[model samples]
Structure formats: C-alpha cells, structure tokens
Target: MTLQLEDEQAQKLPFDYEELAKQVIDQVLGMEECPYESEVSLTLTDNTKIRQLNREFRKIDKPTDVLSFPLVDFQKPADYDLLESDGWEVYFNPESGELMLGDIVISIERASEQAREYGHSLKREYAFLIAHSMLHLLGYDHMISEEAAVMEQKQAAVLKKLNITREGE
Candidate 1:
C-alpha cells in the first residue's frame, strides 16, 4: 500500500503521523480483504484549511474532522475503478507503484477536540481517523444506519488488530 500524507496543520501531535498512517491504512485494507496493491493520499490540516475544503466540495461551510474523496467509480474497491465525474480524480504514484485509491483530508484541530471529548489518546484518535478514511477510500460509507454500523465495526476491528483501542475500553 502507498499512502502519501501532507501535513499542513500547525498543531503537532505526539505520534509519528507518517508511520502510523501507513499502519492504520494497512490494517483497514486487511480488514476489507483487499486482494491487490492499493494506494491512498492523506492531508493533515487545521480547521481553516479543512473549512475551505468543506465549503468548496461539500458546501457545508464547516470544518469537519475528516473528509473522504474516493476515486473508485463504484461503491466497492474490488473493481478499483476511477470513473471520471464531478471532482473525483485518480492517478498513479511513481514512488510506490500502487494504484491510487483516493484522497483524505483530516482536520487536526477537530481531531484533538474529538479525542478529548471521546476520552482517547491522540494516537488512538489519529489511528481511528486514518482507518475511517481508509474505509471511505475503499468505498465504505456511513450515510445510512446499516452502513454506519458496518463501517463502525470495520473501523473497530482495524484498531483492535493494531491494539489501538479507545481509552478505558
């Protein structure tokens, strides 16, 4: 797997984001039963940057903790199709030689707040966000209740595999 992370945030967490991001992505790919090589692009930014993105793409005008831009044409990574439509774009990486999955933008400020509110370590929060974004890259969505439940289970399983559990259980 190839994960390109661009950290544009001012807040510096304790964890090594580059390393942990790869581990979390691998864990999610394993959970999803991905057969071939995969790729993902991640960006760590502050609220302002994420807010700009949210306004441009989602038109929500709010900085969300995480945003997913999946490239797969269909709702499943088994095909890994890069259907050209809307703002979706796909490309290959010369470094890792892996197929491009999609892009993920994470708001560091929001993540910190969520970690505090959820009572988990910053590392655990990062792991969860990265894993959650990986699921989105693999065509997972939480728009519906059933899909949300399934995605939650998959995220939990990925975190469990890496021993990146939530604090106090």
Candidate 2:
C-alpha cells in the first residue's frame, strides 16, 4: 500500500508522517484479505478548510476531525460488477498497479483539541482517527448498532496492537 500524505497546517504533530501512515496501512490491510495493492491520500488541514469541506460535501456546516471519500463505490455490488465487466478499469492504478483507495482529510486543530479532551497523546489520537478513517475507506460503516460494535472492536484491536489504549482501559 502507498499513502501520499500532505499537511497544510503549521501545527507540529506528535507523530511523524511515515510512522502514522504505516500504522494506518497496517490497520487497513490486516483487517481485510485482499491481494490487490491499495493507495490512499491523507491530507492534514486546519479547522477552516475542513469546515468548508464538511459543509460542501457532508452538508454539515461544522468542522469534523476526519472525513473520508472512498473512490470505490462499495454501496452496491452492482457497481463493482459494472467496473469488473469493464475489465477492471476503475480499480487499477496506472502507476503503482494498486487500487485507488480514496482520500482522507483530517483537521489538525480538531485532532489536537480531541487529544486534550480524550486525555491521550496527540500521536494516539491521530492514529485512532487515521485508523477509523482507513476503515471507512475499506467499506466499514458504523451506521447500524451491530455494525458499529464490530467496527469499534476491530479498531480497538488495531490500536491495541500499536500499544495505544482507550480512556480508562
């Protein structure tokens, strides 16, 4: 997997880019059994930019910590079928022979605030958010109770592997 990271904010994050990206990639690939290569774009922005994105894409005028835009439409199997029938045109990345996973936008300001609120290091908070967003990229949704429980469990397991603990845990 290849992760292209970009930071638009001037804030000094606790984790380095390579370490954070590796953790996210490990979480995403470990949860899924796929032979195909994958790629994702991670952009760290400020509150204002994220707010604009939230309002424009999600129709919510507030800034959120992270937002994921999946490239592969996993909502319907028919969409996958359509792409498959077209000789897998949509899944392949020309340069790396990887599937374009999608983009993840994170608000550095929000993450910092959340770290303080959660009583955790900024690195742990960033890793958690990145893991959550990576799951979303891989078609994991928390819209339903059961689905959310399962997703949360998977996320916790990944975090635990990286020696990150949740509050009071």
Candidate 3:
C-alpha cells in the first residue's frame, strides 16, 4: 500500500502520526479483506483549513474532525471483486498498480480537543479518526443507525487490534 501523507499542521503531537495512520489503514484493509494493493492519501491540517474544505464540499459551515473522499462506488463495502470487475484501469494507479481507495483529511486541532473531551490520549483519538475515515474510504458510511453501529464496531475493532486503547495503551 502507498500512503501519501501531507502534514500541514503547525502543532505537533507527542506520537508518530504517520506510523499510526499507516498501521490503522493497513489493519482496516486487512480486516475488510481487500484483495489488492491500495493507495490512500491523508492530510493532517488544522481546523481552519478543514472548515473551509467542509464548507466547500459538504456545504457544512462548521469544521469536522475528519473528511473522506472515496473514489470508487462499491456494490458492497470492501468488495474488492466489484472494484476489480469495474475496469481496473480506472481504479488502479497506472504506475504503482495499486487500487486508488481514496483521500482522508483530518483536523489535528479537532482531534486533540476531542481526545481531551473524551478523556483519552491524543494517540487513541487519532487512531479512532483514521480508522473511521479508512472505513469511509472503503465505502462504509454511518448515515443510518445500523450503519453507524457497524462502523462503530469496526472502528473499535481496528483500534483494539492495534492496541490503541482509550488510555493510550
């Protein structure tokens, strides 16, 4: 997998964000049984930039913790077969031969705030957000109650597997 990560935030966290993000992304894909090599881009920024993006794309004037932009429309979430069948040239990166999963944008400020609010470490919060966004990139959404529950379960599972607990363990 190729992770193109761009860190544009001024405030640096205590932990290695890139390493954690890669672990979470890889774990999510593994759990979902994605059969192909994948490509994902992640952007770490502050609330100001994320707010602008949120307003422009989602028409929501407020800043969100994270945003996901998925490239493929899967018949089922993490259905690699469907992705492979629907013209591989469109979904696969020409040079890397990796499936272009999607993009993730995270607000470092919002993540820290949420971690404090939830009484968790920043590492756990970041992992949670990345897992959530990775799910979105794989075509999973929480727009409905059932879907939300499933997403929550999956996110928790991913974090637990990585040993990223609420206590930052």
Overall lDDT per candidate, in order of appearance:
0.81, 0.79, 0.91
Better of 1 and 2 by lDDT: 1
Candidate 1 off by > 4 Å: 77-97
Please, what are the lDDT tens digits per residue for candidate 3 over residues 119-169?
999899999999999999898998899999999999999998999987547
Report the C-alpha displacement of residue 158, candidate 2, in angstroms.
Answer: 0.8
Candidate 2 lDDT over 54-141, as tens digits, reads: 9999999999999999887666411334445655666779877888878999998999999889888778788888888877877788
Lowest-lDDT window of 10 residues in candidate 3?
79-88
**Best-to-worst ranking by TM-score:** 3, 2, 1
How many backbone collisions does model 1 have?
0
Considering only N, C-alpha and C atoms within 3 Å, which residue pairs clash in candidate 3?
none
Residue 22 of model 1 has an lDDT of: 91
Pairs that clash in candidate 2: none
